[model samples]
Target: MRGWGGTGCPGFANLDKAEPLKRGVQCPLANETRVFRISDPETGATCRYAAVPSSHTFSSAQQVCTSCFGGQLASIHNYHTNAEMQFWGGIEIKDTEFWIGGVIDYQNQAVNCHWADGSSWNYAHWQQGYPQHSGHACATFCVTDGLWRSASCAQQMPFVCEF
Candidate 1:
């Protein structure tokens, strides 16, 4: 058999052969059944999602995701690899930048973001002219553009919540 790296075949292995398993269907793995919910209050479309954890800076996104659908801010996963071109999160900034999840680590100091799932802020997608470090605080998602941008969390913008 060939290993994951596709290196040389194992000893006495049938590299070119294909093995077929029994035809009986099998149940999905427990972990694979995990689901996250998302909702759009404007359109009233409730959706179950399986997406990687993302970060955003909009209370409206969280409110819409939770109140309208039934999900909370997205959570971080250690094994996540597929890069999300864009998604929502829970980091907000306005007059005074502060994390919606309850902490203000990103400022003149450095990019310090965190999530409720205990994941570190290693990835982010900021909108044009974002992370503006000049007395700007709070974070949220912009519904018009559907991208994560820095804003006043207290300014009252729509947010996305994860399940």
Candidate 2:
């Protein structure tokens, strides 16, 4: 099942009727720290987006973020942050999906989705009926609906970096 983000678009209105799909894993990096100066002209904030290769899994992508970009996977907090990510990711990746900082808690057998940065996963924009309990232990931000979706951690996809 897919998740929903906006309501004006097709298939976006029926998200409430959709079923929760498999959830992903969100393990924080140890001693991971870095900084960048990718300034957003609109918000006047410094943030950056790094696109991992399509052959990198969500776990490996996190390493890329910590080692190469000096940051972690993008941690979206609100609609504006999500929109900004969607905008820049669309321009950078064009037609590819990317990983974000969301993971599920399999130990508890629940959808305890949390960000890699240790932020609370209070805000969400699932495609429609997603976060299934399938065996997919990773999360990816889909370009089609601009919403978060579940995937196998081993599945390779480009990823975004946040500073």
Candidate 3:
């Protein structure tokens, strides 16, 4: 039940994941890097994620996370995780649009999307009528509505790392 960023998780009142932090308080940060860790007691599954200190395009961000954190871009497998990411880390808010662990290479084949971490692309919260791809495209999540949109893999933006 340790808080992230080694700062005793300022303003965090509990370890319960169901309870979001108080309004106006943000996730723990170490020198302006947003980071947090969550574990499911029932399954003993834990995930630690952070907004990468540097922003880059999708592929570059992937390389950065792999080299620095030994992790991949944070992947959203379900609604709960996505919501937790939004609430606990604000990874997307780190930028107007931030890179997540998703890339779309298959044309209009949402089922074929893959995460950099090699996680199954079981869930997606795409923006309306999105995935209009002609070739390879990457995914970007926006905080406005927590919806994902397709973007060029070469677009520079903030990203998250998870392991």
* Model 3, residue 18: C-alpha shift (Å): 35
Instruction: Give per-residue lDDT, candidate 1, residue 126.
Output: 55
Report how far residue 120 has shifted in candidate 1, in Å: 3.3
Using lDDT as the measure, name the better of candidate 2 and candidate 3: 3
Q: What tens-digit string does per-residue lDDT give for candidate 3 at 1-163?
A: 2212333323223322223343422232345455677665545666777675456888777765554454678888777777776665464355667888898887454435888787778899998988667678888877667789998898798887775
| Model 1: per-residue Cα lDDT over 62-163, one tens digit each | 443343223444532221210121232222212212133322346665755555334466555456766654443554434334344555555543222343
Q: Write candidate 2's Cα lDDT for 45-85 as tens digits.
A: 55545554344788877775554444577877677777767
**TM-score of each predicted structure versus truth:** 0.37, 0.67, 0.72
Score candidate 2 by lDDT.
0.61
Q: Comparing 1 and 3 by lDDT, which wins?
A: 3
| Candidate closest to the true structure, highest lDDT | 3
Model 2 worst lDDT window (10 residues): 1-10
Q: How should the candidates be ordered by lDDT, best one leading?
A: 3, 2, 1
Query: In model 3, which residue pairs have backbone atoms overlapping below 3 Å?
Result: none
**Alpha-carbon shift of residue 117 in model 3 (angstroms):** 1.2
